[model samples]
Target: MSVTLKLATSLDGRIATAAGQSKWITGERSRAAVHQLRAEHDAVLVGAETALADDPELTVRLPGYAGRQPARVVLDSRQRLPTTAKLVQTAREIPTYLVATEAPQARLTDAGVRVLQAPALGEDRPELKAVLEALAREGLRRLFVEGGGQVAASFLRCGLVDAVEWFRAPIVIGGEGRPAIGALAVAGLADAPHFRRTEVRELGDDLWERYERI
Candidate 1:
């Protein structure tokens, strides 16, 4: 299965303010384009922090998109996913999955969410490779990993990301802002991950850069 990681951030590489206020970082065009991207993938995934903070519906919202929406998946390693989350509430209507390392949450399972158990990574986080294998077994061949920084970093660090779609807004979020990607250990310049730019387009005041692994 191929995994594509997508994120929208400021010119300073910050995805949110210090307080986690991330709404409206990119314009309407970028938001609409994200829906299109979601439509092209077999599943849309987010980390537990994103599920809790954003409460995203993770469904195609475009007009005349009556086709089947992609499955929604969450990497909640500890099974802390709330039963009242929108993903859980609408699981029966649209397929929703919770990948965890610990025991399944009964309330969420009773609410029609597919709870998956997998191997743990560093600090009890769900390993991305196992999650991808689980997803692929269910026929989710193309994955769209929409993020909170830690999730993206995990996949990239594991060398599981096949491509990246990063949208950069014009403005800069200075002063203690949250970075788009978390810490990556590197001793020298050769340790950085490199990508070949495939395409670049303007989305309102934002610039969307698409890159493939090199």
Candidate 2:
């Protein structure tokens, strides 16, 4: 299975402002490109915190695009994803899966969400290896990770990320803003995860950088 992490952030690598506002980080063209990327992947995955904060539909919304929508998967270890969330509301129409350490919640299951269990790791987070295996069994081999920092870091830390599609805006959000990636516990430069830049181009005011794990 291959995992691609998508990041649409400011030039300073900030995904959002200090107040947690993240809408429209990139321009129209970049956003449209993301929709295309969604169509290419088998499933789009995010952490529970991102699902709670953004309430994203994770659907491909290109103009007049009638292709099969990718499945939406959320890493919600404690079953924290709300039943009222958009993913849950449209779970029956678009395959939505919730990976958690706990048993399936009645509300979520009744809402038509498929719950998968995975072993917990640090801070009770779902283990990445098992999560990927479970997803692979469901025939979701091409995974797209749309994140909110911690999720991106988790995949990098576990060496699960195969490629990266980074969209960088012209503006900078500065140090006070939220980072695009969280702590990876790299004690030295050599310990950091490295990726070889494969492509770079401009999409409107944003720069799309593609990288493969080296």
Candidate 3:
């Protein structure tokens, strides 16, 4: 299984504004590219923080692209996903999975969404590697990870990311915003993953960089 990490950030590497305002950060072209990637991937994954903050529909909504929606996967280690979330409400049609702890599986199943109980990272956090392996076993060949920083960092730190598509916007959001990549528990530079830049294209004011893990 190949896992691709995708993200859009400011020129200064900020994902959200100081006040958490993140709408329209990237232009239409970038958004269109994202939808195309979503349509190509088997499932789209995000962390609980992104789910709560964005409340995105997580569907491929490009013109002439109807009826092609990827399965939505949420990493809610503590099972903190809201019942009224768009993912849950549309699970019957698009299939949403809540990757959580063992205790929340029953509740999530009762809510009509498929639940996968994986090993906990701490008391409630789900192990990232285990969750990815399970998804791979379920025939998820191409995993697209869209995130709010921490999730992207987890995949990169674990050396599980096969490719990365990072978009750099023209705007500059100062401090008080979340970074493009969150902190990792690294000992030194020797632990860093090498990436070979594959492509760099400009979409209006945004710049998109594609890299393959080396």
Highest TM-score against the true fold, candidate: 2
**Candidate 1 residue pairs that clash:** none
Q: TM-score of every model?
A: 0.97, 0.99, 0.94
- Over the stretch 1-214, how does candidate 3's per-residue lDDT look in tens digits? 7899998998888988767888878999999999999999999999999998888889998998876688899998777887788888788888788898765655567767888778987647688889988887777778899996988888888888999999889988876777878888778888788899999999998999999988
**Ranking of predictions according to TM-score:** 2, 1, 3
Give the alpha-carbon lDDT of every model.
0.91, 0.95, 0.86
Error of 2 at 91 (Å): 0.3
Pairs that clash in candidate 2: none
Better of 1 and 2 by lDDT: 2
Question: Over the stretch 1-214, how does candidate 2's per-residue lDDT look in tens digits?
Answer: 9999999999999999999988888999999999999999999999999999989999999989999999999999999888789999999999999999988899999999999999999899999999999999999999999997999999999999999999999998899999999999999999999999999999987899999999
Which 10 consecutive positions of candidate 3 have the poorest summed lDDT?
102-111
lDDT of 3: 0.86
What is the per-residue lDDT of model 1 for residues 1-214, given as tens digits with 9 covering 90 to 100? 9999998999998999998888889999999999999999999999999999888999999978898899999999887778778899999999999999988878989999998888998899987888999998888999999988999888888888899999999988986999888877756878788889999999878899999999
Ranked candidates (lDDT, high to low): 2, 1, 3
lDDT of 3 at 196: 96
